[model samples]
Target: MDEMPALDKMIIYLDQLAISQIFKIKTGTYPSEAPHHAFWTEVTNLLQQGVLLQQVLCPASDIHRDESMVFTRGDELTLTHEMLGGDTSFRSSSEIEGDQVWAYLRGFVSGKEPILDLSVDSILDGHRNEWLSRLHISAAMDWTGIAKDVRDRREMSADNMVPLYERWRADPKTSFKSVLKTELESFGSSRVTAYLHFAEMARRGLGSIPNQFVE
Candidate 1:
């Protein structure tokens, strides 16, 4: 059988867990007034941090009637599989050993934690702050010159790699999958190994793993 593409694999992994399921939010006017940006930003952060499996918004609805203060009701919130977009599809890694690769990707992109907690507001707030911090760090690191350092350390001569490297560098919006594939090919690393390394890095940054391979 032909091996599935890396991105397809990620999507399949997410689909298996039904993580694409849509959920709803029910709250009082105050909570409902929370901006969509705040809600989504929090959800994405949680997913990235492995806090939530999936993050989706609830369907829009009109107010039916105003109810008087009822302690029993106290703003009901329900999560269901009815809010996801009709055309939404997973795109990341294939399922491997029961791990939802797409779920991981969703978390990566959304910056949300994996474990879902009922304290939506608090979780969202934390994620927002974390997201801002990450942005700041990334912005600062943009001038690190690490890419040049790594290129210089590589054994392969730049003369031979000029063409390909130039093509990649010239592209303003290079896709991550394409970049991963290119780097793996250039470094003579197997796709699986490269992906494993990337996953580990996502879980634990550089130097977290002592060795790349284990006996």
Candidate 2:
């Protein structure tokens, strides 16, 4: 965390693809004659100024860091991921989904509805303005290990999806409610596992768990 700004900043999450376009424009990797180049340049300039002025907070997550690894380190496309994010880091989607599932379960157990908030503020590391530091990588990573892990995960996913599709085909659901129970159970377990992976990352300082948040 860094010193807090006097005002709360609005959160702006840039999509990975748009970030890549901006990088291409800035690095001249995209043709100057391309009509779309000017649009990205303006966007890049606006966001840079907004972040620099503390008028907006752009928090990146482990998802961004991991996805950027598709490009080699120091690649123009790689640095694009960092330009506006600075030191701000957000919770992984896995953690948020887990929290959602936990909330829904608690609501069912207590016989009272749980109103879960899965908004940006719920996952932010600190005050909106506190992470306004120089450009920083949101997660500290072991690139080689991550690369291998990704390959293995994809291969395993391909194999597992076969049974998943087989189960769906056998079920023959005619309505959303027909499969709601199975969907909830399946996703709840998946979310828990994903959250645990994030929990491991948090231990290494790549992410944060709020003092009051529970898995």
Candidate 3:
């Protein structure tokens, strides 16, 4: 059998969770699907640091009654099928750290070690200020030079990547996915890594996504 694409791997990781399955059955909308921006907005809120998986399963924020189109009843066979192959460990109110949520992608993208600060900074160069405001970090650290430092790494030289980051900065309207696609291809990373990065970063209210790249 062919290996699953990285993006699908990430999607399946989410889909295989019992809570995510309930979200699908009750909401009748995939996390990637639209018409439920508010739903996902709340979901992303829960995905932030410190929030537990059980809390996300029943967020403190109320779901707008009108927006919830519960086409699949909770006890339905279809819903059961969805959860049959899911990871049900969280059904017991087990705490899920934000890091644990995207662990699958992190493992795939950079192996056991987390994505380095240098690589993360490179991806968020133009948008660092916006990202830093939301993500708490040491104020004393010099973040201004991180992008350049990562770009200067010897491993990236063969990919001719320096120009790409410049181009992304030059074009304010560039779709993040487009830039990410190029980077992943050049760096020999999977497309799933790009989408996983996008799900975490681009969706962080930094900027408008180009229509062509809409989920």
The CA lDDT of each predicted structure is 0.35, 0.71, 0.39
Candidate 1: stretches off by over 4 Å: 1-30, 37-79, 82-188, 191-215
Using lDDT as the measure, the top candidate is 2
Sliding window of 10 residues with minimal summed lDDT for model 2? 133-142
Give Cα distance to truth, residue 164, candidate 1, Å.
19
* lDDT tens digits, residue span 49-128, model 2: 88888788666776666556655642455455555666565888778866887888799899999988867689977667
lDDT tens readout by residue for model 3, 39-144: 6556444443212222211121011111121323322423333222222112112223233435655876866755433232222112211211223221122233
Q: In model 3, what is the error at residue 75, expressed in angstroms?
A: 1.7
TM-score leader: 2
What is candidate 1's lDDT per residue for 36-127, written digit by digit as tens?
63664455344443322233322211110011011123122111211221122222123221254444556778999644333322212122
> Positional deviation of 118 in candidate 1, in angstroms?
38
Model 3 segments beyond 4 Å from truth?
1-69, 77-79, 86-94, 98-173, 178-215
Full candidate order by TM-score, most accurate first = 2, 3, 1
* TM-scores for every predicted model: 0.17, 0.63, 0.17
